[model samples]
Target: MSEVAIIGAGYYGFKPITDEVSFREGTFLAAMRAYEQCNIDPRKDVDSFIACEEDFNVGIAISNEFAVDQLGGVLKPVSTVTSESLIGLASGYMLIKSGLCDIVVVEAHSKASNLVSPEKILEFAMDPVYERFLNFHPNYLASLEARNYMEKRGISNDDLALIIKKNKENGLLNPRASYSITVDLEAVKKSEKIFDPLSEYDIAQYTDAFVVVVLASKEKAEKLSNKPVWIEGLYWCSESSLTPLRGFSTNALELAAQKVYDRTNLNPKYIDFFEIDDRFSYRELMHIEALKVSNKDTIKKDLREGRFSKEGDRIVNASGGYLATGVPLDAGGLARVYEAFLQLRNEAGQMQLKNANRCLIASWRGIPTSTYAVCALSNGA
Candidate 1:
């Protein structure tokens, strides 16, 4: 099989506001760090570049056109992916596997602090004629889904509260998780409800951050770095954008995980851990279910037994996830990938996992879109 490994990864910010750096500068810092890790001179060694961004988020019709200069792609081939960042990572993998490039870079960033009315902009994602007129907040979508999924799976409010407490606390160990906090179940239970069945604490806020990853073919990867995180299995599938046509069954993650697991001949039990999109508290659970980390019959039981905790058999979101880091817009998925890269390389400080040789990472496009990205990474084992 064709082998591609992530040789380097870097980021600039993980904060609610990064007014200090423009997206271009943020991406530059991140890419420079990633390139440095692999001892790469991007202007010479990198073959192509992929930027995960959306026009709406950046307020430009073709924003990535402006991203090239900062990435050392002034005259090189560059592509833009409007999907989640992991999709761009997968695109880079395809480029390598297709014999089109020996080395590639993937990046995603969020400058959400510049957007004045993000809620209004987010509303535009709903079906223009069908759903937008409902005239309520978009997060209600997650609330409804969480309520439905919990009911079917016997998940309760306490489970949601535990998820909040666990992940936010996990954030304490991650320097990048500005949203990280030490909260108990009681504080979570008392949090204000923003949507039915979902409180403000249940959702991840937005942050301005950039994540860049350098991937190379097996030969170059080995030549460039002593520690490489190989892409064992990678795939991303989005459920239909038309919400009415879907069942909200974690279909996106299931489809993507099935493809990834099939590629690596691995299963949930075989994985060392996972770093999934906890854009919402229950989403972490929903994604865990979809990845088959635990069967529905016992997932709730597993939670009660602390099997998904930091020290549990199934370690998830070791970076505090989006719950602690806030959302990074298109960069959200890549952020999850960033966490996976850290654990596999033993760079995830206090949250580090012993012998973290393999992990699964997942991401969602966030409200109004059921699109998701799921990834599996190994320490080139």
Candidate 2:
């Protein structure tokens, strides 16, 4: 496979909705910013474009049309992946690896403000036969997963609260984060309950935002930027859609993780930092176990010990993660990778970790459907 690297990255997003701008305007601003940062003329340099989008979120079936001109993909070979943001990223990687394209621009954005009934949109993701009939809130799936984690692995509510507190505190230093506040464990526990075990604070907030990144082959990257974050390995997987039938402790994330790890020949212990899809607070813990970074029983203990803090040895979600940071549907995964790219390049301002080298980024597409993507990035290949 041809080596791929992130030559430049740019993002423009704010908390809540921006009435001053339309969805296309907001996304265009972000794409332009990324192109400027790369210092590459998009019209002349980029060979193709991969846009990540979903129909319901944008109130339009073909959201890619909104981003084409702004991304300098006016008449290029642009493709849309509605599955997940990371899947779109995977498509970009494949395009470059095949030698069909050397420089590819990937963009994803979410103007959740356009959705009149976001919950109704989420319902469409449920299992048509069994789960959708229950009329359960989408969060009930997280609650069920959390409940199973507690019963099968002895995880505690206090553990989930601690994770929330830590991630929020981490967000305080991130200027781009939407919900960067300090909250105590008691405050988290007192928050309104959305599900039996999951509270409102335990879940990520919805926001309108955009994120974009530029990828290039090794030769192109070397000529464009002196500091390039190498894409060592990337993989994605999905498990059975029948969430009710599968064991709560079982997740397909491990399969994706193993695939990336094996391809990169990197060990979990070697990873210096990570940006995981913590759509729910408990997901951070569950993903830690699924990635085999730590045992299920030790997640809470490790979190309390500041093992995952920005200042800790193994920094996790220094950009506040999807939980503390707002979740912008399709753009969430790219945001995580953007943070990783900044950290690896020593460009992350306050949330930067010391001498960061290796980083892992993972994204999950919520419940019922178990879609996951894992990308391994490093300063060196």
Q: Against the true structure, whose lDDT is highest?
A: 1
Q: Candidate 2, which segments miss by more than 4 Å at Cα?
A: 247-250
Q: lDDT of all the models against the reference? A: 0.87, 0.82
Worst 10 residues of 2 by lDDT: 242-251
Model 1, range 107-151, lDDT digits (tens) per residue?
899998989989888889989887888898888888888889888
lDDT string, candidate 2, 1-381, tens digits? 679998888877757676777877787788888888778888888999988877777888676676687787887888888877888888998999999999999998878777788878888877788788988777787787788777776767777777787788888888777787888778777777768788888888887788888999988888888889998899999887777776463457999999998988887899998889888888888788778777767766787797887767777787888766788887878888888898899888877788789899989887656888999989873
lDDT of 2 at 75: 77
Listed in order, each prediction's TM-score against the native is 0.97, 0.96
- Residue 20 of model 2, lDDT score: 73
